[model samples]
Target: MDLQTLTYIIVGLTFVLYIGIAIWSKAGSTKEFYVAGGGVHPVVNGMATAADWMSAASFISLAGIVSFVGYDGSVYLMGWTGGYVLLALCMAPYLRKFGKFTVPDFIGDRYYSQAARTVAVVCAIFICFTYIAGQMRGVGVVFSRFLEVDVETGVFIGMFVVFFYAVLGGMKGITYTQVAQYCVMIFAFMVPAVFISIMMTGHIFPQLGFGSQLIDAAGNSSGVYLLDKLDGLSTELGFNQYTSGVKSTIDVFAITAALMVGTAGLPHVIVRFFTVPKVKDARSSAGWALVFIAIMYTTIPALAAFSRVNMIETINGPEQTGVAYDTAPEWIKNWQKTGLITWDDKNDDGKMFYANDARNEMKIDRDIMVLATPEIADLPAWVIALVAAGGMAAALSTSAGLLLVISTSVSHDLLKKNLMPNISDKKELMFARLAAAIGIIIAGWFGINPPGFVAAVVALAFGLAACSLFPAIIMGIFSKTMNKEGAIAGMVSGLTFTVAYIAYFKFINPEMNNADHWLFGISPEGIGIIGMLVNFGVAILVCKVTTKIPNDVVLMVEAIRFPKGAGDAQDH
Candidate 1:
């Protein structure tokens, strides 16, 4: 059968499975909707959390980012995964013991102020929207290629699928659905990497293949390391060595810190811990998620190396010169239809050339690299189709998680807890569903018109979280004297400063986005680290001048810090 037909069958089956899970797990109360009745198993929640954590960025964009940026992309690796370690070790168990339904709920009650909750609601909504935009864009990219549809149409279709399960299942449905998605995503990701690894290096494992010598066409050693060969090929095309980095030391540190702290502060990821029945289960889930996440993360660099090698050879031919444009392979023609791969013959030689200089004749979008890898490697038809399914699973899983945060922010944080304290449970549930649907439409618009590439846009969202939420959560848990005035002031100042800097460089004045225009040579993607410091400093300064914390609030903080057993935290 043709690739397209096989893709429809496999992807359709997965959709049916998701829809069925949603129906079976449809949440009946606000508790189930918000935290899956707070009875989810650690192992099950771990799989779901891993799916939510990976998102489109890990599955679709990480390898692509690594392939193009070379060594600089290591920041993402360290930042994202390291941030999870921070979350697991320092925050997850304590937050679960805090017994709050959402981040805003914790901030509000911990700070003993409705205003603080409101600020958290705004920050959560903004960060989630920023992050969801990338997932939706990833969805559109996958659909446009495999389904032969325009990006906007693909986004609209994706919105329907995500909204259906999200609105219906709430956390209950999304949790189970994401577990299934994790399976599909991991399976889909590993199959291609294993195939390409054996094909290129004659190794069974991609991790070993990563450092092993390349096998020549005749199944013999080529006497060249993969990175060494890639570096040589890169120099021939006037590009920097594939293993080198260009980002400054400070920028690297700043971006890595931002991503790490941002991951810790993300509202959606934190809420996963609340789904488990006990604080200990939260810790267990975090450990399992790390195990699941590490599998995919370890394979990424190898895949990036393999993909870079395959793509360069496919486009420029084995001679390291150029290939005739008219005779370009089906992958180019297919991707070109989506307007992602562009070719212009500057030399009028009818041959395509890729380089880091003005002689470059092709504009290939990084988003296509992972999706196009199977096709470029001449994998079987079903394997190619499986990638499309896998991409959808990755994008939809995270998108659902983000939409849940947005909805809960509106319904539970803003309305039920603040605006309509007397609202009925049934009515609040309805509003939550309504909020989720509206979030979907708005997120779809962002997907249709993303500000940047998937990884970059997602990185900016991380910065936002780092700047606004991390300090508040940390101090609220660890510091008894962190009053509401301090927390509110810190979040506002940090968010405002980070947003203005990112908007100025990224949107208002694109020409001034260079290092000369940056603060301490930190790009917008890394500015959140500065923002987070601003938050910490402002919160501390404001706290010293404010009234002392009430004795009861101090006890609450102490109880949260030294928990005795699962679900042992008292309601404040």
Candidate 2:
């Protein structure tokens, strides 16, 4: 089949599978809608969580960024995966023991204040919205590439599919759909890696091939490792060495810390624990989620290295003079039509110079590297089509998860809990569905006109979560004296600080948005670490001045800390 036909078939099949799962797993009650009736197996929930967590940022953009930035991109790999360690150890089991349907539920009850719940609802909504927008944009990118449509049209189509399942099946449908997505995305991701690895290094495993020596066009093996060749190529092109980093160590550490904490605190990620049947299951599921995530994370480095080498080899032959424009591969010719890869013969030599200097004849967008890799390597058309499907799966799964969180925050926390305490469960479910539709529309808009690069947009979402939610959630679980006033104040302050910083840099004054203008040399991506510290400090100071926590709330905190009698705890 042709690429377009193959993409339609594969993407259509996955859509049918998701809708079928939605029909099979239709939710019947509030519990089912919000937490899948608290009956999901740990492993299944783990797979769903993995699918939900990876998003388009991981599936499509991560390795692309790594291909350009080299070792500095490892911050994303480490930050994203390491945060699960904090989730499993510091948050997940305890929150599961709390037996709540949502993050706001836990915070509201723990702080013993509706005001706290409302603040949490606002934070959850904002955080989920910020994250969902990027997912929708990712969906659009994939759709545009595979379906031959503009990004806006792709986003609308994805929004419709997501709305159908998310509004119809809620958490139950989303969980099973995400399980299917996990399989589709992982398989789609690995196939190309394996093919490219074998083509490059005679190794079936991409990870091993990344460490193996490069094979020349004549099939002669060289003593230089793949990374070594990549570094040499990069340096020759006037770019930083591919195996090393250019980011300051402090900035790298801060960015990693922000991502780790943000991953732990993200409402969508945290809510996954509530779906499992037991506290122990929550812990086990977190580990399982990590294993699934590691599969993609570990492969990213290899993909980056392999793609970088392939790109360099294709453009600049070993003799140093670049290929003539007419002699470039069909893949390069094809992508040139998309304007993602372009060439200009500045010296009128009719030969391309793919380098980092301004006079270089070739330019490639970092975001297109992963999607373009299979083509760059001259892989089968089917692999290219499979990648398109995988990108959509990644985008759609995470969008559904975030939509659920946003909808639930409005229906359960804002309306039912704060506005209409007497609202019936059935009526609330209707409101939740309506909220989800509206959220999808708004997210689709952001997707069409995304604020920044995919990964950068995603990084801001993480910063918001790290700054606003992680600190409060941690204190609520671990500190017996955490009060409503303190929690509310800290959440509001941290959220405001983080959003303002991001807005100023991203929108207000783009000219001044650099390390020189940053506080402590922290970029917007790493500013969340400072915001988190401010939140912790503010919450603790306010807690000290406020009246002591009620005896019941203190006792509740103690109860969540242990695993015993967790099965009997009532979900408030």
Candidate 3:
């Protein structure tokens, strides 16, 4: 079958599968809508959590960014993966033990103040909105390319799909759908990696092939390590060595820290733990989710290398000058259809040359690397179609997760928990569905008019989460003295500081977004670390001066940390 037909068929089937799962697993009550009835098996919830964690940022854009930025992009790999481990080991079980419906609910009740909950709700909505923007954009990118629609049109289509499942099934629907998505995503990613690994290095595993010496079409070793050759080729093209990083050490640390803390604080991922029945199950599912997540994370660097090498070899040809424009591979024209890759023959040599300097003849968006990789390597139409389906799966799954968070924040946290304490469960469910529908529409708009690239936009959301929520949650559970006044003050200050810094550097003045203008040489992406510190410092300081915690609230904190009995605890 033609690539387009295969793509449509495969993508259509996955959508059908997702919708069917959503319909079958539809929530019947407020509890099911919010937490999937709180009876999910650890392994099942783990798979669902993995799908929720690995958005378009992971499956579609991480490799693409790594391919372009080389060693510097390792921060993303380390940050996101490390963050998940942190959440699982340090927070997930405790949050599960707290047994709140949402992050805001946990904060509100833990601090013994509705104000604390409202602040958390606002922050959750803000962070999830920013995060969902990237997923929506990812959906649009896939649709625009594989389905041959306008980017805006693609986003609207994604909005509808996500809206249908998210509004209908709520957490119950999203959880089961995510299990199917995880299977599709991992399969789609690994197949191409294995294919290219064998094609390039005579190895079955891309992870091994990344370091293995290259093999020619005759299956003879070229005697040069893959990374070594990539490094040499990179410098030849006027780019930094592929194995060398250029980001300052401090900035790298800050960005990684921000991402790590932010991942733990992400409301969507945290909610997955609530779906499981027991605290131990939360911990178990977290490990399972990590295993599933690592499958993709480990393959990213290898795929980045393989895709980069293939793209360069195709564009620059054997002689390394350029390829004749007319003779360029079919992949070039295919990507050009999406307007993601373009060429201009400046010198009129009728050849397209890619370089690191201003003389570069092509305008290639980094976001296209992964999608274009299979085509560049001459992978079959079915394999390419599978990737499109996988990308869509990744994008839609995460968007649904984020939309659920937004809805829960509004319907459960803002309304039922605080504003309308007397609301009926049925009415609350209706409001949750309404909130999800509206959230998707807004998210679709952001996707159509995204603020940045998929990964970059997501990084900012991570920063926001890091600054606004991680500190409060940490203190809430660990420090019995944590009060509403301190937590509220910390969240407001930290969030404000991070937003101001990001807005000033990223939006207000993009020209000065350099190390020279940055505070302590920290980029806006890494500023969240500073904001987090500020939050911690301010909250601790306020607690020291505030009135002592209530004995009742103190007792509650003790129980959340250490459940009353041994056998009774398990039964509870």
Candidate 4:
């Protein structure tokens, strides 16, 4: 009945469902653990991939970002979804045809070098760990607010749930569970968005609501557009216009390109392509996956617009410049208790002003907006419960995917393939489960003590993927002459440059804030574009200075590109 009780019930039910699925589908062999025995249907695989891809960043943070940042947030919407198009058109079919167990398998064999594979493993692990930290933080934030627990404790509970399923089910367990998660999360996200849309604009579709005219009490058109109103409000509060072009055109173009490429290049996501039975299925799966993702992606802008308008209207009005602290709404009181949203009456006035006062700056945590949407909109308690469950589903599904990748790389790729060639499949599977459990523990700890915002950490992960892994994969596939030396050099250069750039801005230098960052005035968020260029350039330069590639490696590259010879290219 109450919010806290409802949250606990929802989370508890989802956890039970996941554990039950894990038990029912427990993996018995190395193949099952790694790729679900490669028997998954295309549509099912598509849904699972969507679940794996969305993560906490999509479910918890994206709309909140758009709500505050306005049209500039379209970069995230376009870049992330567009990356899937790249994956489907440029990467997925070919890689699935190559039929390797992991991204490194393709790199290692294609380049004919153990060193190249090792570099890929290093890069993959870096990206996964960085990304998982954010998901863990999302889980903690949802739990702390809904279930009324400390963030650390919430993270521990999340870690246990991830370890339970990932260790027991492996890819087989994770895949089926993710399908269920996708359903839960999508339903949770859409219900409140649709409700809010209908209430504000008398339209059922959020996309249309974003462009619709605001109606006044007299039923006359307000004449001012939603985007224009948002722009004006933001400027008044010392923030940039919501719909105006704040970032340079070049920076926007580069960031969007990098995100597209990086999405296609992520090792964990690429591995999902390998789980389907046929190469053709993999290609089709990408399209279906994008369809599922687009449902949320398209609606997010509308949610951002509605929430922004609602937030402003509630805080600033003729009768009350801001909501009175003592008489604040129930949702406000509930969220304030979590310390995610806070208010102060700096002027000792009964009314609250939504203005940008330094002392009265509202500390509305971004993650809370989606979770608290039901309460803010006065939806039924069941809807609020569903949101809590959905947030957990989003967080856990991603954590499972990341942990599975980490475990497989350690046990299957490194230990079984290289360190202990004589090891049995059963022993390797055992070690894989162990590695997954250990990885979950480490990830949970970081989630309990997050380093930054959810989107910031996710973007950094994308940057790393763009810098290191993307270059190596592209060069390895396209260039017949690229050798181990060149690939290694490129990866190291890209990794070092991107990481150093982020660290410099994030910690070492205060003045070079993300907004002011530039290589010729490019924002740090868009620096991945430059880092990718450096990778390609360094790889080509190093390859030219070195000897020609071996004849066998060239043949391998040819085989990877052509569908006819791909059937025999599987690792081992």
Candidate 5:
């Protein structure tokens, strides 16, 4: 079959599967809509959590970024995966014991204040919307490339699909759909990596292939290592060495810390813990989710290395033998039409060389490397179609998760809890569905007109989460003295500082366009670290100044932490 036909088939099949699941598991009650009726098995919930946590940024963009940026991109691999350790160890079980529908519920009850809950709802909404926008963009990109539609039309199509399942299924529907999405995305990711690894290093495992020796001309196995070759090639192209530090050590450390904390604080991820029946199950589920995520996280570096080497080899030749630009393969032509990879015949010799010539520089869009891999490697059209379906799965799964969180916050936390305390469960469910539909429409608009790169936007979302929600949750769980005043102050301070810093550097600054952003010499990607520090500092200071904690709030905190005999606390 042709690539287009195969893509349509794969995408259509996945959509049908998701809609079918939604119809089968249509949520009838508020509990069912909010937390899948608290009946999801731990392992099944773990897979669903993995799908929810691993967003479009992870599935569609991480490897592509690493392929171009090389080892310096290890921060993403380490930071993103490492955060789950914190979630499992420190947050998940305790929150599960709290038996709350949302992160704000934990904060509200622990702090003994509706104000705290409102603040949390604001933070959750901000984080989810910012994060969802990127996923929508990922969906649009996949549709445009594989389905051959305009980006706007692709986004609208993606929005409708999400609206259908998310509105019908709620968390119950989204959880099962995410399980399917995880399978599709992981399979798509691993298949390409396995193929590329075997082609390059005679190893099926990409991690092993990344460190293996390169085969030289005459089939002589050289002692030159993959990393060493990559380092040399990178510098030749006016880029940093693959293994060396392009970012300051402090910046790297801070960014990693912020991402870890942010991952723990994200509302959609935290809410997944509520679905598990037991507190211990939540902790175990986190570990299982981490293992699933690590399967991809560990392999990404290898994919990056192999793709880098392949890209360099294809664009630049060994010093002795060079292929003419006119002789470039069919895959090159296909990608070039997408304007993702373009070359000019430098020196007018009709041969593209890997040299630092400003006028003759070859431009390659990093996003294309992963999406175009099957074509580049001469794999069958079905594999390419699988990739397209996988990308959609990744994006749609995450969007559904985020939309659920947003809708529930509005209908359950804000409207039902605060405004209409007498509202019926059926009315609440209807409002939740309405909120989800509206959120999907807004998110779809942003996807069609994306403001920035997928990774950058995700990082900013992490920064917001890190600054606002993380500190409050950590202190609420760990510190007995943290008051409502302290929690509210911390969230507002952290969120404002982080968002303002990002806006300043990303939009307001003249010279600090993404490439040049630095505060105390840290890039914007790493600035979340600074924002997190300020949040913690301000929270502590405010707490010290107002050292009074309510007696009831103190008791609530104690209960959440010491749930030894609490036999599967009922979800409120």
Candidate 6:
């Protein structure tokens, strides 16, 4: 079958499966809408969480990033994965013990103030929306490429599918649908990776294959290790060695720290724990999430190396001069049409040089490496089709989870709890669905015409979460003296500093977004760590000056810290 036909069959089938699951398990009440009736099995919830956490960024962007930055890209893998350890050990079980419908619920009730709840609701909504914009963009990119549609049309179609399930099924529907998506996306991701790994290094495992010897496109090896060959090629082209990155040790440390803390702080990730049946399940579910996530994360580095080597060999030849532009491969020609890969033949010699020098004749976007890898390796038509489906699964799964977070925050935390407490449960559920539809419309708009600042919003989401939410949640459970005034002040101050710093560098003065202009030489990506510390500092100081928390609030803090007899989670 043709690539387009195969893609339609596979992607169409997955969408049907998602919609069918949504219909079969539609949420019946507010409890189901918020936490899937709070009876989910740990393993099932873990799989759903895996699908939710591994968005298009993890599935599509990570390998592409690895291809360009090589060892420097290890930060993403380590930082993101390490955060789950923190989640499993430090936060998930306790939050599940607190037994609330949302993060803002936990904050507002634990801190004993509606003002604190309102602030958390605002922060959670902002964080989820910022993150959702990227997922919507991922949906658009996948559909535009594989479905042969314009990006706007792709986004609209994606919006419809997500809206159908997320609005109708709620968390109960989403959780089960995500379980199926996990299977589809993980299978699709693994197949292509395994094929490429075997083709490159004669190893069945991509992780082991990445460390094996270099094999030419013709299936012959020069007896050189893959890393050694990559290092030689990179150095010859004026790029850093593939294994030896150029980032300062501290920068790497800082960026990794920010991502790790941010991962722990993200509301979407934290909310997944609320779906499980009990505190033990919350902890176990995180372990399962890591196992599922590890399947893709470990394969990424290998794919990056394999794809990069294939491209270098295709374009630069063994002699290292260049490939004749007119004789470039079909994949190169196809991608060039999309402006993702380009060549100018600068000297009119028709030779395309990919080196870092001024005479270089080719430019390739790092983001296209994984998308183009199948074609570069001459893989089967079905493999390409599966990849398109996989990309959609990743994007749609994450978009659904984030949308639920947005909708629930609006309908439950804001309207029902604070604004309209007399609203009936049925009315609240309807409002949640409406809120989800509205969120999709806004996300679709951003996907079509994403603002300059929107691209940086993901990092800011993490920074905001780390600086604003993580400290409040952690302190509210661990410290009896963490009064409402202290929690509120800390969240506001940290969010203000983090957002202002990000805006000054990223949006207000784009030219000053570099390390030369950074505070303590920390990149904006890593500035969240500083922001996190500021949160701790400000919260402690504010608490020292403010009145002690109510005795009941202190007792509640102690209650959450002890998980013994923490029964099945139920939305209050």
Clashing pairs in 4: 321-352, 322-352
lDDT of 5 by residue, 25-79 (tens): 9999888899998888889999999999988888878888787776667777788
Question: Model 2, range 178-235, lDDT digits (tens) per residue?
Answer: 9999999999999999998888887899889989987767767877899888888888
lDDT per residue for candidate 3 within 253-288, as digits (tens), equals 999999899998999999899888787888889999
TM-score of each: 0.98, 0.97, 0.97, 0.95, 0.94, 0.97
Off by over 4 Å in 6: 216-221, 453-455, 567-572
Comparing 3 with 5 on lDDT, the higher-scoring candidate is: 3
Each model's lDDT: 0.91, 0.87, 0.89, 0.82, 0.82, 0.88
Give the per-residue lDDT of model 4 (tens digit) for 288-399. Answer: 9988998899998888888877777666643424666667668877888888887766677765566555634467776677887778767888888898898999989998
Model 1 Cα lDDT, one tens digit per residue, 1-572:
99999988999999999999999999999889989999999999999999999988889988998988888889999999999999999999999988878999899989989999999999999889988998898899898889878899999989999999999999999999999999999999999999999999999799999999999999999999999998998888887788888899999999999999999999999999999988889999999999999999999999999999999999999986899988888999999898989999999999998888888999998878889999999999899999899999999999999999999999998998888889888998999999999999999999999875445566568888999999999999999899999999999999989988987887789899999879999999999999999999999999899988788989989999985566632222
Number of the predicted model whose lDDT against the real structure is largest = 1
TM-score result, candidate 3 = 0.97
What TM-score would candidate 4 get against the native?
Answer: 0.95
lDDT (Cα, tens digit) per residue for candidate 6, span 1-572: 89889999999999999999999999989989989988899999999999999998888888998898899999988888987788778999999988888999999899889999999999998988888898898888888778888889999999999999999999999999999999988988888889988887888899999889867668887598878878888888888889987777877888899888888888888889988877888888988988888899999999999888888878887688888877877789877766678888778888778887785788998877877888888899899888889889999999999999999999999998899999998999999999999999999998988876655788898888889998998898789888889999999999999999988888889899777788888877888888889989999999999899899888888888898655554445
* Candidate 3 regions with alpha-carbon error over 4 angstroms: 452-457, 563-572
What's the true lDDT of residue 46 in model 5? 93
Q: After superposition, how far is residue 394 of candidate 3 from its true place, in Å?
A: 0.7
What TM-score does model 5 achieve against the real structure?
0.94
Q: Positional deviation of 166 in candidate 3, in angstroms?
A: 0.8
